[model samples]
Target: MATSTFRVNVLLKEGVLDVQGKAIESSLPELGVSSISNVRVGKLIEFSFDHEGSSLTDEEQTKLTKVCHELFSNPVIESYTLTEVK
Candidate 1:
């Protein structure tokens, strides 16, 4: 059977305070790692399906995006981008 992979990049929206990201950024100077600004963190989630390429229909992609928004991301402060991995 043919198989494929896709990914969802989940990240906090701009202007939202990212405590973890800030802490890491502030700590970097202490650790002697400089020049790293705008150090925001995000998550990558991959999904494997028993389908080939972008064979999944638009409706299927829509449903999967909905799932990503509802189940994987916090709509209040987070947004996500979906990509079909080759």
Candidate 2:
């Protein structure tokens, strides 16, 4: 079996109103930081898979997407991207 590492980025969709992101952004000026705008807060998740002498295929990708939607992200307001890291 081969072990592979993957990364998942989960973010709220555009215009979804990230409350945490907004609060942090609003506080930036008080922290003496200006010139920054449109801040976003998202999540990064790293995980691995062990496959039996086979590379990841489309079916595995689909399963990963399903896991993202079902467990890691809120499908109504957030979206996610997956990448296999070298």
Query: Each model's TM-score?
Result: 0.85, 0.88
Question: Any runs in candidate 1 off by more than 4 Å, and if so which?
Answer: 51-54
Model 2: residues with Cα > 4 Å off, grouped in runs: none
Best by lDDT: 2
- The residue-by-residue lDDT of candidate 1 on 46-70, one tens digit each, is 9876643447767667778788989
Q: Write the per-residue lDDT of candidate 2 for residues 1-86, one digit (tens) a residue.
A: 78899899999999898998889888998989998888889999999877666687787767888889999899899989988889
Alpha carbon deviation, residue 18, candidate 1 (Å): 0.5
Compute the lDDT of residue 65 as modeled in candidate 1.
75
lDDT of each: 0.84, 0.88
Candidate 2, lDDT over the whole model: 0.88
lDDT of 2 at 73: 91
> Looking at model 1, which ten-residue stretch has the lowest summed lDDT?
48-57
